[model samples]
Target chain A: MNTLGISVDAWAAWAPGIDSPNDWNAWLAGDSCLDEGVKPNVSFVPPMYRRRLSLLGKMAVLTAQQCVDQYPIDSSLRLVFASRYGENARTVGILNNIVDDGSVSPAAFSLSVHNAIAGIFSIIHNATEPSVSVSAGQETFSAAWIEAEQILWSQMENADRVLLVYYDEPLTGDLTRFTDDIQIPFSISLMLSKSQSNGESICLQNKRALDSSDSSLNESKLNQPLSFLRLLLSPEQMISTTTSNWVWVKNSANA
Target chain B: MSDLIQEIKELIIEVLDLEDISPDEIVATEPLFVEGLGLDSIDALELGLALKNKYNVSIDAESEETKKHFSSVESLAAFVTSSR
Candidate 1:
């Protein structure tokens, strides 16, 4: 068993296929999935970063806020953002400006990169700790987990905790051709600390694949972040003995 | 003057998604920002774009007078009328 495990977790997603799941109960139930004709209302959102952020950034920021509420961790906690496609629509808008109009908005061009979400997360949360954004195709899942584990290891030595977030949205237009296999807007956040409790805790081994019954479980079984979040919230699925996954809360303060 | 300001008020309400506030509720002398409708910097920028596209008013962010022009729907309408 890995010495450390995930502690608290939260998730959010855009599942046009499902209604009534926007509430917290449906999220915990893991019933969110995407279909079509579903778009988030950006108006009701706060106005601080609304001007600079697109729809994706708004969703990411909202999800991150929910995660902070769920875990109630310290503001000093570090954050990690993982995505398979980073601001693809924003990229298209800038590229189209350069190609069709011969001009691009400098602000839009700057935010089009993959790390924009991470940067926004830091600014929104007012965090200054070291944070990283990772993109690794299909291996994004394993790669992010490993990176989080490494950070946790270092933080543990210093006697601290870490926050990790995994999020991905569907690409629009031509970009969809490259990443249509998983079709759901999803984001998941996990808060890790050195604690153990009645909560499920399991050690993770081979990052390759979960070959047991857990392996058969669809990662995208539900909406992107919501599906993984359901697993985290569910006490029943907290510890996957068949696979190398676990979550435990320890009372001991010492790392 | 009243008709122009009223029309601009409606446009501002629509463009900014001010569901809670009606155009009629906005007073000509009241501030449209923190003191009145609680609009923030983002809303100001969006309103700036909509106004530029709808009217021929040119706004440069570097100018202090532009901020005063957008302080209220009345001022914006007056500015638009004068510039037009």
Candidate 2:
């Protein structure tokens, strides 16, 4: 119901075969497609710490690192990580272990929580500022955006930026029947600051406020994060996506 | 004894997901935590579970002897041998 203004200072995204800005630009133009069964290379991470990361965790951390590398934020920058299904593969492995032998690997169980990736990121980067992990089914990206905006608005003076990371992978094995939303594996990180005059402004709106026949409205075939990434990449001014109870209309601030 | 020591080294590598390091690279007399292999507490728990499952050796976490037994591959091999 409330309209908030913010600017994305910098952003970086990573998918299976999509790494560079050129690759994303090509993907946005439909010139290339995401290659399956490929994972992001995170060899820069120390082996001891890297061993603990699952593929989903690796994707999230890789994007976060790349985003921060572009903007060069200090350790004080707050973090908001959102995922529709956090570490699904690791969770499934633990569940299968339970069903098989009545014993679970302690390391797997320890890192199974939703906040594990965020915690690891903070530890690796020495970020002492507060961090929040969010998951709201299909509205994960939008919810995380709202959470970041709230943090900035609530602390207008001290908090200048919040790093928002969104990531998810398609459900595999027997869990694939539950949702038709996510079909790819990708992670997107946006470094958001308060809206500035010259920067690209973004505003979130409830879809019910607009006229039903508005021609600017476009539906997305991809999931929430990917759809939002498409909005970011394309020349289009607006995108409308819906969950069961909520329909969010995100558009350029001026549009 | 050497074969058991080699087996414990391989177990550490497999249980901790040490993808880069090989069995020969792990010194039997060197420490397994913090200094040598640089494993953390979580890895310790994981290795303990693995040892229990593979060797049927129970580890008493509260005991000081447990710490010594897990100090190195040689100590772990000795512990496993004695337990058997």
- Runs in model 1 lying further than 4 Å from the true structure: A1-5, A8-67, A86-136, A155-160, A195-255, B14-20, B33-35
lDDT by residue (B1-84, candidate 2, tens digit) is: 999998888888888899899999999999988998788899889999999999999899999999999899999999999998
The count of backbone overlaps in candidate 2 is 0
Write model 2 residue lDDT over A136-215, tens digit each, in one string: 88777888988988888885536878999888887866677887674778899999888865556676666777677888
Give a tens-digit lDDT track for model 1, residues B1-84.
998988898888776766556777888878988888777675777688677778868889889999899898889988999988
- Per-residue lDDT of candidate 1, residues A155-217 (tens digit): 353525566667667787767777634556655556655445555433344434333555334
Report fnat in order of the candidates. 0.00, 1.00
Evaluate residue A95 in candidate 2 and report its C-alpha lDDT on the 0 to 100 scale. Answer: 90
DockQ of each: 0.09, 0.94
Supply candidate 2's per-residue lDDT for A74: 74
CAPRI verdict (incorrect, acceptable, medium, high) for model 1: incorrect
Worst 10 residues of 1 chain B by lDDT: B14-23
